[model samples]
Target: MRDSFDLIGIVMPSLLQGATVTLQVAAQAGLLGLVVALVVGSLRTTENRLLRFPLTVYVEFFRGTSAFVQLYWAYFALPMIGVRLDPLQAGILVLALNVGAYGSEVVRGALTAIPRGQLEACRALGIPTWVAYVKVLIPQAMQRVVLPMGNLAIDLLKGTSLLSAIAVTELAFAARQTVSAFGNPMLIFGLVLLMYLVLAAPIAAGARYLNDRTKRYVA
Candidate 1:
């Protein structure tokens, strides 16, 4: 056991490097989700029947299903259908779609939360609809969503652990490797927990801070 200390030390850096993969997966998924959120949320806000109905269908589809199933579909089924991606790509793609479906609602609500009168005035002032949305509405909506989106991002980050099932060597995968090597579940999982906390705490703090300040834009 004592002799394994050197082994553990040598492995920690590799674990962290693997964790970087987890971080990259989360970041890519979250960013892609954010883009989807913007488009779907805008459509929801605009009330375009064509766009809204389809977006609604997507939201319901993802929200109704388990993320684990979605991951499996991407990893296992899509390749069979000829839309192939590596394990890492599949994990990220599924996560983005899953989270984006929910984030759209958050963004839709944030858009509605902005005072209707502001939108009215933007129209009254000859602001092009797109211009008004970009200059006035989206910023206000962003304020509301920054916190919620940050929370979602953290959830997505933690959820990356599930990727190990598909052979993605992320933080959880690294910990599992550690446990297999040393037969020390406690240490492996304990370190995993600590790493998650370390990664997520700052994002949470930033969310709280932004939430507090965003109130000023409620007008």
Candidate 2:
């Protein structure tokens, strides 16, 4: 037990450093993913088949594939085509694209759930299309989608662990390194699991809070 405590004391700092990297990747990827979700989701709602069809393909391709494969492709395969990205960049890009593909559906469903009559009402009032979307439609749609977006953010946070496979040096990678050195798999990995719970707790709480607030506001 004394040796285990000493080992933990030695490993915790490195683990924390890796956790910081994990947080950074997840935060940046989540923000980028939200932007992708908004643009792709909005494009998908248009009547222009030209725009919609390609966006549809983008969404489906990401959703259908494994994010691990995507990350590996970006980090490994892209170099052959004269496109090389470092591990951090590759990890962020893959996480963003993967979560964005899933979140796009949330955006689309939220927007589509709005009553057509509401849009027609804006039209009757001679509101410009963009203005109607900005002032009325998007705000309401955003409220409805907030909870799902939060859920996506949590999933993205968890997904950052996969970055270890590509040598991103995030928490999981740090834990693996510690385990190899200390030869205490249970102590290292169990702590790693607890670290993940620590990271995930606030996101889940924030989402629940937003969900309640949105429900109250909608009421």
Candidate 3:
């Protein structure tokens, strides 16, 4: 057991290095997803059928499908159609699209949750709609639901494991490679789990801290 642990430790640094890849994927995906979410959410709030119609279809299509299928489409289908993408690009794109679908709803709901009076006040004060949204609505909405976004961030972090299926050399790929060579699957998986916890714990803590601090502000 001690020898097995030592073997796991020997390769752990390599696995940790792979975590950098995981972090890169998740960070890019979450940021892009939030951007997508904000756009779609705002559209959903508006009365425009033109903007709402296409955005609805996009959100539904993404939300309806498995993220793995999207990843496959990115890595495989696009190439078959003569639009090739590298694994990293495909991974990030698919992750962003998938998370964005769900994030859009969160964003829409958050945007809606802001009091109507705030919008009216902003308008009466001669503030631009964009300024009102940025300065007042988005700040309050973000404060109201930091936890959910944090969960999405954590979800994307875990979802990076799926990129391994596309031969991306992220943590999941590194774990599989080490396990194959070492013949100790348990130790390899344990290390992988640990690495995921290491990545996720801080985001969770930060979410809680922000929540607490924001409550202090509101109070």
Candidate 4:
């Protein structure tokens, strides 16, 4: 009993440190993914085949492939091609690209859901296409996308665990190391599960809050 408590005390600090890395990677990747989604989504809605076609290919390729394979390629294959990325860099890049592909569809759907009349109204008012998108289209679309984006954020959070395979030293990797050292798989992994739940709960709550607020606003 006392020994178990002592073991936990020794392990907790390392786990927390790794948790910080996990959060940092997820947050950075999520932000980058949103940017990619916005760009790719907007391009996809345009009539320009030149611009849309390549973006479509990018979205499809990432969506179709396994994120684990993507991470491995970035970590291992990129170096062979003279692009050496550290574990963290490879993890973030793979995560951002993977989630961005899915989020692009969400963004495209949101933007497409806007009424054509609203765009016509903006055009009749002499609004430039860029201005119309910025002032009228994007705001409304963003409101609709909030819930989906929140879901993507949560997915990205869970996806960060995959980084452990690349030696990113994030939470799962830390837990694995602890298990190896202490030979207490149940305790270590149980704590890891609890920590993930703790991290995810607030994100889920915030998403629900935003969803409610959006509904009220729309009503």
Any runs in candidate 3 off by more than 4 Å, and if so which? 121-136, 216-219
Root-mean-square deviation per candidate: 2.4, 2.1, 2.4, 2.2
Q: Tell me the tens digit of each residue's lDDT in model 2 across 141-199.
A: 86889888888988999999999998889999999998888888999999999999998
- Give the clashing pairs for model 4: none
> Model 2 compared with the native: what TM-score?
0.91
lDDT of 1 at 25: 93
- What does candidate 1's lDDT look like per residue over 93-174, in tens digits? 8899988988998988987788889889999999999998888887788687888888898989988999999989999998
The residue pairs in collision within model 2 are none
Judged by lDDT relative to the true structure, which candidate is superior, 1 or 3? Answer: 3
| Backbone clash numbers for all candidates listed | 0, 0, 0, 0
Q: Candidate 2 — which residues are off by over 4 angstroms?
A: 122-136
Q: Cα lDDT of all candidates, in order? A: 0.86, 0.91, 0.88, 0.90
The global Cα lDDT (0 to 1) of model 2 is: 0.91
Predicted candidate 4 versus true structure: per-residue lDDT over 107-162, tens digit per residue: 89997898899889899999999998887777777688888888889899999999
CA lDDT of 50 in candidate 2? 94
**Candidate 2: lDDT of 11?**
98
How far off is residue 191 in model 3, in Å? 1.3
Clashing pairs in 1: none
